[model samples]
Target: MPAINAIAADKLVRLLGTPRSPAMIDIRNDAEFDAEPRLIPGAVRRAFTSIPDWAPDFGDASVIVVCNDGGAAGHGAAAWLRQAGADADVLDGGVIGWVGSGHPLLDTAAVPPRDAAGRTLWVTRARPKVDRIACPWLIRRFVDPHAMFLFVPAPEVAGVAARMGATPFDIEDAAVRWTHDGELCTFDVMVEGFGLGAVDGLARLAAIVRGADTGRPNLVPEAAGLLAISLGLSRMYPDDLEQLDAGIAVYDALYRWCRDATDETHDWTSHKPAKSRVRA
Candidate 1:
């Protein structure tokens, strides 16, 4: 049986990128982390020695601490968090266990340098319709929960990225690594690049995003509806961030549908079932 304070590696995997996922803290030592520089999706790295300084930031929120092998580092950090009044747990097998379980670990190398406050900053073309919003949604949900974005004119994307230390995406440039690859849109590349290709729902959503963003709504049945909604949203909020705040909820719903309700259908006939069946 699993310990009351420990969450199994596989069990944690299912909640890795969801909105209700517990705060994930990676407490691997410097040497261990140097050997493996990746991080589990949505996990933030923190020092075990600095737990006291950071633990308070958790503020009674549930946290799951991970280490290289689920040994002293993870358990110790989780314990410290619990002592601070947070509902904290350790990952049973840690990062190694997650890798051994065949779950994807994000390649930290692809992530841009975080700001002083520890948030990945990115720049892209302004007036986003589909790819821009989808990419940020993916980042906030899976890569960095506190990521920031800057929207600028199309011609200014690269210049802003250079001056502001932001990673540029979805633009025409040989150096921009996050742009489209052949038929795949930026969202698809990110999903694949961040090691989330194996996630069935994200892959499905990526296809729809790709289809909608690239002007090929016929590629997926959901693409047309997504495009229509995205267009409407673009008109609703001229301010990019305001649009994004509203757009997040849209993607959140679409992702849930992709993950949990893909086969579900609703029609007037179902609600108007025969009286005998309705009673039962």
Candidate 2:
């Protein structure tokens, strides 16, 4: 069994793609990290020695500290974070344990450079309907929880990205690596690029997103519903950021459905009385 302040790898996996997941902090030393540049999904690299400066930044939020082997570094960082009043825990086996459990690791190379505040910034075309919103949702849930996005005029996306130090995505620019490839939408590219294709439900979700964004809703039964909802959301919110904020919840629900509820079905008769069922 794991220690009281340590969470098992399998248990942590359940929380990874959810909004309630704790802030994941990777405190592996330079040499250890150089050996394996990937990170647990949604994890950010932090220096264990610098906990004094950053621990308070978490405030009362929950945190999970990860190290090379779930040894002194992780436990020590968690202890320091607790002292600073943040609720923190160590991963039971750290990166080693996480890998041993056959969980997926995010390819750190695919992520764009972060700003000084450690948030990945992205720029995209304004008035988003599908892929634009879906990409941000994927990035926040699986890559960088604190990522920021800039929505600009389609013509200005590239210039804004260059000037503002943000990565441009989902546009027609050939230079943009995050755009669609053939029939795949930007969401599909990101899932594959970030090494998240193996993540359960994401591939299915990507298909839905692709079908919705590319006017190919016939690709999946759920794609038509996603497109309808995405268009409705775009009409409801004129402000791009507000629309994105709302769309995030939509993707969250869709992801959960794809992951856990795909095998289940519901109808008016699901909760009907036994007498009504017998009569039917």
TM-score of each: 0.92, 0.96
Q: What overall lDDT, based on C-alpha atoms, would model 2 receive against the true structure?
A: 0.93
**Model 1 ranges with Cα > 4 A deviation:** 269-280
Best by TM-score: 2
Residue 41 lDDT in candidate 1? 85
Q: Taking the tens digit of each residue's C-alpha lDDT, what string does model 1 give over 213-274? A: 99999999999999999999999999999999999999988988898898878765555656
What number of backbone clashes does candidate 1 have, counting pairs of residues 3 or more apart or in separate chains?
0
Ten residues in sequence with the least summed lDDT for candidate 2: 271-280
The lDDT per prediction is 0.88, 0.93
lDDT, model 1, position 116: 87
Which lDDT value does model 1 have at 128? Answer: 92
TM-score of 1: 0.92
